[model samples]
Target: MANIEQSASAFLQSRRSVPAKMLGLPVPDRAALMPLLTAGLRVPDHGKLEPWRLLVLEKAAMTRLAALAVTRAGELGLDAEKAVKGSAQFETGNLAVVVISSPKPSDKIPLSEQVYSAGAVCLSLLNAALAAGWGANWLSGWPSHDREFLARGLGLHDTETVAGIIHIGTAQNSPPDRPRPDVAARVEWVSA
Candidate 1:
């Protein structure tokens, strides 16, 4: 048990998100991704509501979404830079998993908690992919938050929104570790 705890701590400490552009081919196939998805599902759900669902996008789907992003950007009168940046992920992605937050009508569990669970699932999926020897990054841009884009491109219901889009693929290079937060400054202990 101690060994397991130590290993988990080590993994958590070292986990880093690879840049989406740095990810390449050799993405996980459905068979290979199933176990990772299973791992991702093991997150906190206070009401057992399972207020999250995954949508896997292959290369072709990504291409389609990329085009949609550009069109939506035009319709919205966004700047060229914003449009390019927003659509870049879909344009270059080989495989991605869209973690959708599907809030359920519940009296006990708050909607915020359900949304948090969806965010947790996104992290779990990204971590699972990294642990499985694939590079993974969680990303969300203007396109993700735009209602029109979500409705047309993803077929998301009014109650459903994207929690994250996790891009997974083989890594081109090992990214240098960026500075981490000062945990000591952020922590406050309370004992009563």
Candidate 2:
């Protein structure tokens, strides 16, 4: 049917990313973001662990978070430029969703599988925002990788980590599309 074809095209065309700097907002509110987040929660879960969570960042918390980034970077001796860039995401973002990788302890489900599911959640969130006609970017800067930053800003538990930060907003500019990987190189045909 035409609908199936259209859906396929939309999925393919959706593989684009705009610069985080080029993003400004009118960020989606809780009421507005509910649908977008619900869509993301639909990602593939191997063991139904739902091993990820989202942290919504509103405009009010942006300044405090940015300042925390500055302080955490100093403590960690991270590059100043990188720290500033990391902070800028929160500083400028009108709203954001931090994808927290929270793996449930499971005997049957390996930890790696849960991690993969968290990663899938990130992609799903990114695409959902794009499909909804919002300018969205998924970022995980140095701060995300820093334990100090995670503790101070996100209060990430030992079982959890930052998978990605999905920044949603109105677009300041339409970014150019980058090239995609060749499918043939990345896939293999196996007849069972």
Clashing pairs in 2: none
Residues 1-192, model 1: lDDT tens digits: 999899889989999999999999899999999999999999999989999999999999999999999999999999999999989999999999999999999999999999999999999999999988899999999999999899999999999999999999999999779999999999999997
Cα lDDT of candidate 2 equals 0.86
State the C-alpha lDDT per candidate: 0.96, 0.86
Best by TM-score: 1
Give the runs in model 2 whose Cα sits over 4 Å from its true position: none
Candidate 1 — what's its lDDT?
0.96
On lDDT, the candidate that comes out on top is 1
Please, what are the lDDT tens digits per residue for candidate 2 over residues 99-163?
99999989999989898888988888888888888888889988888887788788898778999
Off by over 4 Å in 1: none
Worst 10 residues of 1 by lDDT: 4-13
